[model samples]
Target: MTKVYLALAHQRQRWMNDLFQRGYKKKLKEEDLFELEERNTSSKLCDEFETNWKLVVKNAKQTGKRPSLLKAIQKTFGVRWCLYGLLALVKTIRLSQKSLTTTTTGEIINLGATDVLRFDFLPQYSQYILIGPIVSIVFVFLLWQVVGVSSLAGFLVIIIGFIGYSLTGPCFGKLRNKTALRTDKRVRMMNEIVSAMRVVKMYAWEKPYASLIEKMRSSEIDKLLQSSYFRALSISSSYVANKVTIFAVFVVYVSLGGRLVSSQVFAALTWINLMRFPTATIFGWGVEYLSESIVSIRRIETFLLLDEKEASILDDIKINTKRNSASIVFENFTAAWDDVNLAYVAENRDATQRKTLENINLQVNDKKLLAVIGPTGSGKSSFLNAILSELPAKTGGVKVRGRIAYVGQIPWVYSGSIKDNILFGEEYKPERFRAVVKACALTKDIQSLQEGEETLVGERGVTLSGGQKARVNLARAAYRENIDIVLLDDPLSAVDSNVANHLFHECVCRYMKNKVNAFYESFIMYG
Candidate 1:
């Protein structure tokens, strides 16, 4: 009876080995199949998104409005499939415009470049933060099944390693903050140096500035290196933990007089190896990424919370689309540029301050022309700014009952055709275009140019001369159809006497006849 039972058991063992081999082979085949399937799935996702984005862009162009990424996605894909990364990006862009007035250019750049990218890492490895623990628990159960009570020793070592890795999260967060700040400083310094390179060369400040930038770069690199060291330790610890877990499990199993069969021993090692990745590698990386993301979120939150431009300040001025009686009225008005401190100053009433334009009492009823004459720092620009609602009111109110067309002191132009600059996004009318060109004295200039109205002016009108740029600026304001007030802030300063006279008489007097014109001239006031 004993011989018969032993023979039956041996037969069953052989059958089980054959079954396991077949299953393992099938798993390898399935892995290959799933890999290709995943690749195709990812490709399809990207292609679909590209098609939808193109449609959104086309619609935006036709309607002349900026496309919302969220709307585009919601239209094509269901709301349930919404990606938080895209949502966060859209929100950042919307809030960032408000931050522009308060935040530095470098800080804004870092938010886009570095802080936004931190979100990318979160979706990839962040799942491991939850999955790691659950998976580790399952692995421990499987390890116990194979190696019995000895598996506890290995799990204890793993738990210790996990706790150690988790503690480094705060350290990584601190390091990331320092690196980000240094990077912003470095970028800001670079921008300032590049912008003032000509002046820097004149003053021989190359070496000093270079040294300062190098010092900043060195500090940034040091923080990054420290972060890299932590990353290396994490990766190395994963390998060490795997080896140590196997060693401890075997040591305890042998000491407990458990006879290790080849199948059971290999199974135990395999489970430990699987546990190492989720427990150590992925968990460590996920924690670090989470820490970095937290820091980034706080930075972005602070930026988005900064004060925005006060559109309400401009609500006081009434808009009237009539030429019957154009006017501007300022009653006990005091204006200032530092709007952030305006409320505080108003509350205290004893702050020592130099007002931009103070205690101004003025009115222009049924006026054709009103000219303001002042010295360099005599609030000439401030007066126009107060009317524009750019300089916020500190004490009293300003009433502007007309649509204003302002030609600033420095003639500004963007990178576009001269005609585009003149039209300024208004519908092009051939007769009106010709008249504005003639009135602003730009007809001869355009005719002399190689491309006439199609000539592409470089950035800030670098390709055009100062007088030509000023004429282009004036033409922009002049080309408008229903402008009731024209504010000329030293517009004629760059032009010669002949051109200035032509612009004043032809454009301001005849072309803008019946309109209220405010001229800020240094020498004379024309009314």
Candidate 2:
């Protein structure tokens, strides 16, 4: 009885393997085959595999060429049956899809929301460029061919409309992008505020912070508006040029009798005269498009050419601030950047000097969370920046000390959830996270809000209070687990003293004491 059972199992496995082999051949033929005369036979008793043909090919090798079985089956049963198979498959899929629709969780949208906002293709697609004009001219010609000379009238109108569109697209995009970039530049200044906490709290410098941010934002707006004005002027210029061409065409059309000339020779002349207006209008539109493109491309080029982070790579600036010193050291250290400095012109301001720091000698050894305080003209922020290697002493630089977490002088947040603002993708440490929150004393403040961590901070955290915003930033920096050395540049110039003192002592100062306990056995690690 055991031998019989083993034999039956082995036989079933062999039959399944054969069926799978046949199905994979891409054959449309039905797999349910048998001698109808032998009704009571053992092989005729099988039921499962005798259904659809496609299921047999389930485990087939994925390949470029169709399998042999499919071809043979198609030849025998014919290709007409293949259509039915595909139709059935599609119907089955649709039915299955409809049935599962409610339970389905994931879907993909083309040109994702995040991408459309971030990427800039205006310069490439802007009609202000030469390609834009040339293409428009060709398009006019083809349109004329399709709709006859009467189409030129609409084409002229369209050209006019395109001119308006071309003018606005680049200018708008540029202003928006500039505003965004300026906001970033402003936020990066937060170092100045963080390092100046003691005096800031003593003086209650909310007004100063508010004023500074307002100025920066104003500067960005002014720049955007100015760029937009230029774009508008460019477009208007193109519009004028096009009108000139249109006027010229009207002059010719009126002088030539303003009617279609059917004669081959005269018709050619009519075509020329009709297109005269269009050509000029197209030229004008092209100008507008190209101008915008040039400005956008030029702006994009400057940033892209900078020896900065490429958009494709996700590497971070590895900051080392282990020593909050008034001095820095570089022993037998080499920072190399070949021919990158000569790209920029300094003009009359040391006109030939393009490099900022190279093989630079500097010191800052006041390691007590030393204040990098200096007059506005003095390179106070620059000094701290140099220590962290954020500025890079002429690129590929080495400092060989400390772990640093940077908080800029300017207070700026993002159009993200509050949790995103505070955590910033760092590993979640509940106790440490709470400690930072409590240290910054934003615990009760945020919890009282309805959304708590899920709160959607509008653009630049527009909805947050200055203190709340600063605390959020502190929370972000505090979460960097390995950060021992804290290098702040006036980050707290906007915060109150109580929160500043607590955060300074416990998170930064007391970390020296707590770091030893890290090696103990009971430190419950999260992941």
Candidate 3:
């Protein structure tokens, strides 16, 4: 397998070199490159391991073996643990999305890129840590058969090496913990810099920010260098230990006034050499990986334990097709973005004074257009957030009986065509698409573009104007079928008076006339 892989790698490298010499080109076909069909694709390998792991987990249950360090070691002795760890990491990531308000992007990145990978590399040598001593004992017995009491000297040397690993393993883990934190800090700062690059450049703050990032990077590198030094020590010690153990056995045997036969000496030496891998090499790697894996698992555990979004908060919300029913009803409802305060308020209703949206009673019947007017930072968006179940409820309850769509205050767009953004993963319907485009006042903007709705918007819709992005966001929600209530979080704030008027008249009052709509604004508007 190694030889085949090496040959394939060389072939691909040569092909890549040729392609680079020809210059990079767009729309390159897969057939244009030299390729080999892989029998073991990642998906196939994962599926195979998953099938095996299910059986292993079932057997473990039958044996009544609960999760523990021993059980984990037994179960993780194979490559399947990599898949197990990855699946768990993915599930944790999904559950952690709501809690991301407190978690930094860099921390999440390290969890996926650095921490999850420790599981993959661990099983390769983990068993050696357990079997290292047992194998050493067996080798000691074998050597004693050929060299009698002299074998005790070799055993002593092995014991010392074991103790050395035990002492240093935790120190390596501590260094790794420090390194991982520095990595997260550096990555988080980089993400902030990338996101705010425009502002940084505008103020000519490039050098200062660059210096800050470099300082962080230097700290991270220093930790990594310390870890490298420790790893070098492990390798060098293992090599020296192997030589010293053999020498000690020979000197002790000769000191016993025993005449050494060539056959017995060579036989004893062979057994000691055989013990080298288990005692020195594999044991060293196992200890290193074990320490690193422990740190990784703890990091992942911390992330998994972060607060998840309270998706079940709106248990009173029910879908109803009846038009006579109220689309949304707020009965003495109070909500707050800070769940800590909400939890306190949960115990004592008097603490509801700190809530973002105080107890309020309101109802919007089906197809009604209700406008919520509030000043900046006066909880206009928080009101929408409460309905969306994003804010934790403090008092009373909110009941909804219809499917709702929301357009946030800040429009979101990914790297995709205008039409794709408008479709938003919904099936494309030509007539509905045309109507939504015209209703959201996006028809003119689309027509002015070279590719019309098919034009690529680039990342975050950078190529489009703010008004255009807002309309695109609105059109996305409007395109969805059977939406009973629509929440607009000051959508008109970015557009001109004319465009806002057009959106209000054509989109809200006319196109979405049958759906209950709520508009958030700083001041009341008759339109």
Candidate 4:
């Protein structure tokens, strides 16, 4: 019976190995397979084989690839089916772990970048970690009882191991706290460098900035080293605890006058050896993973719990039900960009609070123009933002009856061909495209390029000149069809006077005169 079981196990293993190899060959291209095989040859064959097997299984499960199997038993009970289910479970676990890690890291990054923090999802993670170990303990106790290995010596060994595991908890906590602080410092340093890179270069402060960054990096590394030392100590102590348990068990057995009979002694030794792996896994690696996961969970929870901007109250209030003639209306509307004031109002639900833009009324009918003229700090942009619902309305409402297009003061361009940037995912109409290019005075610019309209613009239009970028930005907004209202925030300021005049005449007057135009401060009109 024993020999038969062993033979069956070996056959199952062989069959699984063959399936894995076949799956891998099918999934990866010939060149990739060759590369992997070459790399595999340099490593220990057994280790490489196991890794390849897992990769194949993971790929098959992920891609939903049909596995090659014995035709006779494929429909019914078969080794292939069993292995497929097992592989799927493993893939699911791996995917979940990957997603959790990604989400935790993203949340941490977001929290570090943002000003506010909250703790909404911490309880869920706390409950999971707290319950998991308790359930595991229960299962271990049940398994021991069922296996008939419930001896005083075994119990004592477990107790000692538990104590050792408990000792590492404080060390892990301290390490995790230190790690969070270091991570925050590193992120802040990187953010500062990125945001102030141009200024640093212009002012010849690169060396000073570099020194500051290096100092923070060194501090982070120091923290990491300290954490690693504690981690090593914890792992070593766990290993020692396992060895001590084994030694103590034998000593107790011998001191109790138990005969060193082969069956009794060997059974005890075999059970101890079997328990060793699980003991180390649970008390050693498990504790370390749990501690890290807890810290990440807390960070993520804090990020998720932050007070978000209230969903536009206008979303719930249906507008223009009566087909109102007004293209845009702002009635007793107030707006604010003050973060503290907004947050306070959000918490207090106080609608009477004064904001940047006080209670004001405005209306623009279809095919009309509204030129808002104000000084730099007079909330001119805020007025436009309020109309677009970019800023919160403390009281009253804004009503809009048409699709709006907005071009900001700082021209934004993405990395793509000039044509792609202009088209902006809209269907190409050559006549409309040509008209827009001419209207925005981009014809000469496009004609000058070797690739013409197909020329690739570097990230954020870095390849284009300031005027070229502004023209392209204008072209994008101009090319959009069915725009009822266009909001221009000093779009002409970046370009030359002649180009700006041409843009206002051809694009704003000729092409978009039929649409309602809202210009914040900088306004130009042509009949």
Candidate 5:
């Protein structure tokens, strides 16, 4: 633990000095480049790894060997090669998801529940399952035709086939439900842990919470094991069916020669082709690692390849005065998350998927204070996000002018020092930086620490209190001096009323002291 903390502390110090001297290698707001993200989570990452991560994700149109039909056939021919294939599949899925988020933001809406529930039919999974049975029947029927089997014998074969088919369905159905439910559960559980880490800390219930989550993770492993068992069973069942049919054909040929013109081995070969569809249909259909990765590939591919809306806003407008800020305009416009009238956007059609915000227009003047008020989920955050350029506005709908800085609610704090959170890989302006620290009432918070500004905050700034996190976020927004606009998304919502009042006063006094640019303004969307 000491070594871990020391290593983390050293990393923070290096980044602190680095940001001061060099800053981030690239700007985040730049439209042309994807921001570099260098972190990985172990729990939810693909277990079925793939070496060809870049190949699968980079150009989905050109399907390569990783987790494709071609590769699957190769692996089937030589199962030893499958170990390499499975490893490659994992990396492929992870990288694909990362690329998609990098390229697309607005358009990747969830599929309709009904459509998603038919996941079994998706080509990645369904083609194998459906083809296996169809091929099996076709092979058997063709063999029967060639041999000229009697009506009674053919009827008996069909009855046996039907009985054999019935045994597999119930197990396959359970596997399907288990695969889906478990994956969904893992995703949701992860969200809860990260988003609500504050609650766990405040309650001092980390151990219990972690234990419970680990238990859930263990359950997922168990589910996967169960799926593997059933898949093996499925393969075994196919062999059993083939052996029975082969034995029957041989006995008939031996007892009554000349009744069978071709050897039974030839017929077995036909039956082998027929088995393809069912083997693919039942077990491989639902919960195989390969099938899961394929499902991920589609979502990740669309995300990586989806066209991003070009940055059309004018960033070089000439200033009428030497002002740092500008006003914003929202024309007569309406926004809905889901429009019942929208035929093409058929998904999220449920009325229960309530509208985030309706048609309303408001103007925020330069160097002015505006408070947007509404209950939680009443589009308050939506309104703020629209102005901040995080949410998309219709062409000609949002006409925002001037430079802007933002402080988000529940703002992100990295796994570093309190000061690093404020710096955020930016070139430090010593005077302005110190001013921001004071403005946000963080000087005292820093003094309480052992190493002051250098104090390591650990992951998500877990070492700091909630109110302290808010302060660091506030300082980040307040760091710039010649700012045109500052948008605070409930900056003081977490602090005491008195502290909030003091912080707001400090912010105003600092702004008023500076030569106010015609564009300079501060806004409290949820003030």
Candidate 6:
């Protein structure tokens, strides 16, 4: 029985390896193998098969020598420590590259969130280009000694190759810059499409927006094609340079009346072949990487150097012993979304300096409901933003005595189950959960769902109605047990009058009335 099982496992491994090799060669899609019923085995077995197959593919790509030749070489040579060292170095490089790529990606995301524009993304990629050339030069020098090549000839070849490589830099830079522009345009288009998807559908602007996105994508593809052409030319040139150097060395040796013995000739050729992979990799991918890294570094530097919003003085304010009580006091405060530094930079300083809110004295005592009433463009929302320290305070400041919970004018929902959103990271309590759900009038909505509170809410609650989304948003705030203040930005606006009244009475009046609440309003409520 044991032998039979072992035989089966070996056969399965061989079959999977063959399948993977064919997939690598583009003979079949790897996904097709997964779809086969017979291939459905234990995950552990599958993982082992995959690991072995990857090793096989990697070895095949790195060396063109037959298995028999490799075995013979291994037998002739005890252990090639240089080859082992090279493999280890390559592994280290790959691990470092992965970590750097992840960190750089995170930095790019953070920089995008800031106000900085037109950041170059090339610098991260360009470092490899600088490092690769140095390694290649050292390896070539060592190769010259091993092959007993004339010093003068080797030096001439090195100088020629370096000059040829240097000439491609300007072309690569130009291509990279063009590619960067196209990439920026594509990103902008994608952001616009995502943000205005609802408006686009409502206004029947789908065709136009789609066309615009397609146009940008097409333009980006064109830029990529042009860049690829330059990249291909550089790679081909590097390969040709290697060939030329070998020919030149042979000619120089013969001209110098140097007897080229078979052993010497073969050794030189073999060493050259060994150098080909790293040399080609350095000149080809290294050029592209350098161009990209330079752009990335510049963009990151520009973003990092941008004048960020000054840290709020209130950040250092300690919470008082009155944890259950919350109060906010803004004394003759003047605030704006615009940067104060911009006023100094502008030609017409006074004209450019526009305050969103000016001389706004406001106070909301602990456990009191404060209503802020205003007409259109009356800076009602700005008042709330100022309290949150989102808008910069030009004169005076806001003092908040406790933690805050804010429900924005636009209801925000994350992708998760309803229960998860409400619970957030807090310890789940069934009683409090039930109470908040009922208070927010989400009981019926939860019951109607197939999975109840555990039902998955699609991205940004796309699956829920406007009123349902607003209620869930409200429930999340209401469910927080430790909230000392609640800032409601017309939460009732999305629901019907009946539901609004119910929510106001149950959720706001009964529950939140005891907590300090700042409610922004644009209309009168009969209730």
Give the poorly placed runs of model 1, Cα more than 4 Å off.
Answer: 1-83, 88-101, 192-215, 255-259, 311-335, 339-373, 376-383, 394-402, 496-506, 521-527
Worst 10 residues of 5 by lDDT: 106-115
List ranges where model 4 is wrong by over 4 Å.
Answer: 1-157, 163-167, 170-206, 251-265, 306-326, 339-354, 522-527
Off by over 4 Å in 2: 1-378, 388-403, 415-419, 444-464, 482-485, 512-527
- lDDT tens digits, residue span 152-232, model 3: 999999999998987888878899899999999999999999987878999999999999999999999999999999899
Task: Report the Cα lDDT for residue 494, model 6.
Answer: 94
What is the model-wide C-alpha lDDT for candidate 3? 0.79
The TM-score ranking, best first, is 3, 1, 4, 6, 5, 2
Per-residue lDDT for 451 in model 5?
A: 99
RMSD of every prediction: 12.8, 22.6, 7.3, 13.0, 14.4, 14.4
Q: Which ten residues in a row have the lowest lDDT in candidate 6?
A: 85-94
**Cand. 5 Cα-lDDT:** 0.54
Task: Summing lDDT over every window of 10 consecutive residues in candidate 4, give the lowest-scoring window.
Answer: 85-94
Of 3 and 4, the candidate ahead on lDDT is 3
Clashing pairs in 3: none
Instruction: Residues 1-527, candidate 6: write the lDDT tens digits.
Output: 99999999998788688777877888675566656344233353335433443354346437942112122223322243112210000111222211232233333443354212222222233344555566567766766775545634654665665566567666665665666666666676677678778888899998988898899778878877887787777778767766766787778878878778887777777766655555554655555555454454344433322233334444533435255557899998996655433112324335466778899888888888888887868888888877776666778988888878889888988899999988888889999999999999999999999999999999888889899989988988998877878999988889998898898889988878778888887874737
Steric collisions counted per model: 0, 45, 0, 1, 32, 19
Cα deviation of 216, candidate 3, in Å: 1.6
Candidate 6 contains a number of clashing pairs equal to 19
lDDT of 2 at 262: 44
lDDT of each: 0.79, 0.49, 0.79, 0.62, 0.54, 0.65
In candidate 6, which residue ranges exceed 4 Å CA deviation? Answer: 1-154, 170-174, 191-207, 249-284, 303-318, 321-324, 340-351, 415-420, 423-459
* Candidate 2: tens digits of C-alpha lDDT, residues 471-509: 787667766776544555565667667666665566555
